[model samples]
Target: MKAGLFIPCYVDQFYPQVAIATLQLLEKLGVEVVYPPNQTCCGQPMANSGFQHLTKGCDELFVKNFANLDYIICPSGSCTLHIKEHLHHDRHEATATAIRSNIYELTEFMTDILKVEKLDASFPHKVSMHQSCHGQRGLKISQMSELVAEPFSKPGKLLQMVKGIELVELSRPDECCGFGGSFCVFEEAVSAKMGKDRVADHINHGAEFITSADMSCLMHMEGILKRQKSKVQVKHIAEILNASL
Candidate 1:
């Protein structure tokens, strides 16, 4: 099936390698992926900042770029959740609905749609998994620890398929890293503290690196880790999954 790649603005500008890894991973699986030349932000930053009404242009651009695709896959759960829940156009409600239904976060697409049971990738390192809030709660990719249900994770499942990668367990598995887009800017003290705490958890658990599908969260944690002179590095899950050896 044909798929459209929706690389978030921050990812496109700041972390292009994640986008590149995502593209390479999908193509390796023999999927026909299209990168829309006119695509931009999913308007999530503005919407999460309480300016959702001002996202009309972004919404229209999204719909225009992706309406015809069978699936619109993004490496970010935050952006995909925003589009799934808030992408609405008064005059083009049908298109908006279509786009929303077609959007899938990367791991979700890989596990749920592609049914990828194993990978040819390998990473010989001890790593910790950061379950991004959006990927866990918004997408229901795994059971939230507080939910009293059997725990599972699509991203974690994919990670298990990689050779020589030891997935370390965290004390608190799915806590927010405090990089809630604009939440970090408005609540600087709390954001930094939360980031520090998150990094500490991974480091304490013997993680050589922290991996997650959301670069925003990883970026926040990476800044704190660097300041603390920690050896743990941050990587997008796509990078690990797409690794050749």
Candidate 2:
């Protein structure tokens, strides 16, 4: 299938490796992936901060870059959710709608659309899974702990397919890492505390690394883990899925 890769602004700038891993993973699965050289932000930061009405430029650019692709797959759940929910251009509502319908976060695209049951990757480490709020709750890639329903995770399922990887359990599974974009800046103390607690949970449970689909959340927790000089490292799920060892 023809797919366009939507790398979020932060991932493009800070976590380029995650984007690379995502690209490699898709190619390994035999997808014809395309990268729009002029693609920019999904206008999520502005929209989340209560300025969605001003995201017309971003929306238009997104529609222009991705309207023709069979699928627009992104590694970021937060950005994908933003486009799916807030992307709109008054002059081209149909284009906006088409974009939204075709866009999907990486894990969802792999599990739901690709229906991948196995992977040729290996990681011999004990790891914990961090379900980013946008991917887990918004995209419903997995069942939330609060819901009275069956438990399943696309990311977790994919991880299980990899060789020599042990998935650890967290005390409060599916809890937010408190990286709500600007929420971290506005509520510094609370955000830091939440990150610290989340990191501690993974560390206490013997996790060598914490993995999640959202690099934003891992970036937030990485800051806290670094400040504490913790041995635990944060990794994006794409990196693990695409790993050769």
Candidate 3:
């Protein structure tokens, strides 16, 4: 299947490697991937900040660039969730639906669409999983405990299939890492406290590396880890899934 890659602004600026790894994995899996140069922000930063009206230009830009495609894949869950949940055009219900239905986080794309049960990747390290709210909850990409459906899963199972990688459990697995976009700054005390606790849990479990589908959350956790002088490093699931060492 042909898929259009949607890289968020932050990913483009700070985490281009996630996008690169995502593209590489898709190609390795035999899926035709295309990156439209015109593609930029998903209008998420503005929309999530209660400025949905300001996203019109971005919305128009996105529609103009990717409206024709059926599968829109993204490395960052926050960006994909924002676009799927908030991209609006009253006169273009079809366009809105197309955008929402087509978007997929990397893990969902692999386990659901590709039905890829195994990967030829290896990483000899103890890893802790951070379940990002957008990927785990917003998109409903995986089964959440709060839901009534059969237990949803993609991250854990996929990682388990990889050779030499040990999946360590966090003390509070599903708790938010306090990176709710502007929430980090608006509630600095609470956000920092929460992030510190999350990082502490990972360290307590002897995790040398922290991994998640959302880089924003990992970035927040990384900040706290750095300030605390912890040795644990944060990595996106795409990087882990594409791991070689």
Candidate 4:
């Protein structure tokens, strides 16, 4: 099936590889993906900073670019969640609603719409998965720790299918990486401490790499890892899922 690809602005600027990997992985899985060049940020930065009123143009442009697609897929959960929860264009309300309802995070699309049971991929490394708040709590990509329900993880499930990849267990698996967009900019010290704690979980558990569906979270921990000058690296789950190494 055909789907419109929504690569987050940050991903396009700082992490194009993740966007490329997502495109490749989807194509590999028999999806016909189209990237709309006019697409921009889902106005998440403005909305998160309490200037949501400034996103009128952003909302209008987003709906214009993606309204025709049957499904919209994005690599970043934070952006996808933003659009899913806040997309509004007063003149195009119906189209905005459809875009919101049809948009899916990359992993959410894989495990739910694609219903992938296996993959022709390999990643022989000790990797730990970071359950990003947007993907987990917002999108319901995994079971909440507070809930006494049967635990499940769409990302973890996909990782398990990769050959030679060892999905490590974290001491506190679902902790936030403290990259609440502008929160990191405003609450510097607290955000750094929280990120350090989250990164430490993966390091102490001997994780060779940290993987998450949300690059914003990984980017936060990546900064912490760099400050510590450790050899650990952060990768979007798309990179891992699309890997042959």
Candidate 5:
């Protein structure tokens, strides 16, 4: 099946390696992938800042670039969740709806759409999985703590296939990293403190690296890890999945 790659603005700017790994992993899985270079932010920043009106242009532009694709796959849970719930166009409401239904976060697409059972990638490291809020709560990539059901993790499942990789357990599996988009900019102290707490869990658990489906969450924790002069590194799930491929 054909898929369109939707790289979020922060990822496109700061952590482009995650986007490249995502593309490589999907192509390695034998699926045709296309990237819309003209695509920009999905208006998530604007919406999160309470200026969703400014996202109309962004909505229209997204539709123009990704309409008619078999699936729109993004490496970011927050951006994928934004399009799934908020994307709209006054002139092309039907197209907007179709794109929303077709879009999938990277791990969800792998486990649900691709039904990925295995991978050729491997990473020999003590890695901790930081279940980002959007991926956990919004996308349901993992079972929530408050829920009474069988626990599952789509990303964790994929990671299990990687050779020599050890998935470390966290004290709090689904806590927010305090990188609520513009929330970091508004409440810098609270954001940093939350980030430190989140990073501490991984470091204290002997994690050499922290991985997440959402790069924004990783970026926040990366700052904290660096400031504390910690040896732990942050990586997107796609990067580890694409490793050795």
Candidate 6:
């Protein structure tokens, strides 16, 4: 299948390795992937700040670079959610619908489209999973509630398939990590408090490394962990799933 790789601006700079691993993993699965280098920000920074009007040029650039692709897959849930939720064309309704329908987070694409149940990867460590707000709640990629439906999972199940990897459950499994984009800066007090709480829970659970789909969230948590000089570490899910012993 032809896939358009969309690397968010921050991912291209700070977390390029995550994008690299994502591409490698997709290639391993025989995906015909193309990197649209002309592509840049998904306009999420502006849109999330309620200044979506400022991102019209960004949206146009995105549409120009990737509108012709079969499927647009992004490694970051927040970026994928931004495209699915906001990318629109006031003059072209069909174009808006096409972009919305084609966007997919990497995990959702692996589980839903690729139907990959197992992978030839291994990580010899106890790991904890942080469900990013966009991938878990916004995108509804996996079941998060026991009260509503039968227990379903894509993240945990996929991790379990990796040899020498054990999934550790967090105290508040579905709690937000407090890296809600602008929310982090605007509410620094609450954001840091929530992130510290989440990190503590992972440490208490004996997790050597904390992993999540969004590097933004993990980066936030890592800062607090480092400040406190905690032995625990944060990792992106791509780093975990792409691991080899």
List the lowest-lDDT window of 10 residues for candidate 4: 33-42
Which of the predicted structures, 3 or 6, would earn the higher TM-score when compared with the native? 6
List where candidate 6 sits over 4 angstroms from the true fold: none
lDDT of 6 by residue, 121-167 (tens): 99989999888888888888767864578777677777888898878
- Writing each residue's lDDT as its tens digit, candidate 5 over 106-209 gives 99999999999989998999999999888889999999988899999999999999999999999998888999999999999999989888898898899999
C-alpha RMSD of each candidate structure in angstroms: 0.7, 0.8, 1.6, 0.8, 0.8, 1.4
Q: Write the per-residue lDDT of candidate 3 for residues 135-230, one digit (tens) a residue.
A: 887877766776677975688778897789988976678888888998887899999998888888999999999998888999899999899888
Clashing pairs in 4: none
Clash count, one per candidate:
0, 1, 1, 0, 0, 0
- CA deviation > 4 Å runs, candidate 2: none
Q: Write down the lDDT that model 5 would get.
A: 0.94
Q: In candidate 3, list every pair of residues with a backbone clash.
A: 143-152
Superposed Cα RMSD, model 6: 1.4
Please give the lDDT score at residue 13 for candidate 4: 95
lDDT of 3 at 23: 86
Q: How accurate is candidate 1 locally (lDDT)?
A: 0.94
- Models 1 onward score TM values of 0.98, 0.98, 0.94, 0.99, 0.98, 0.96
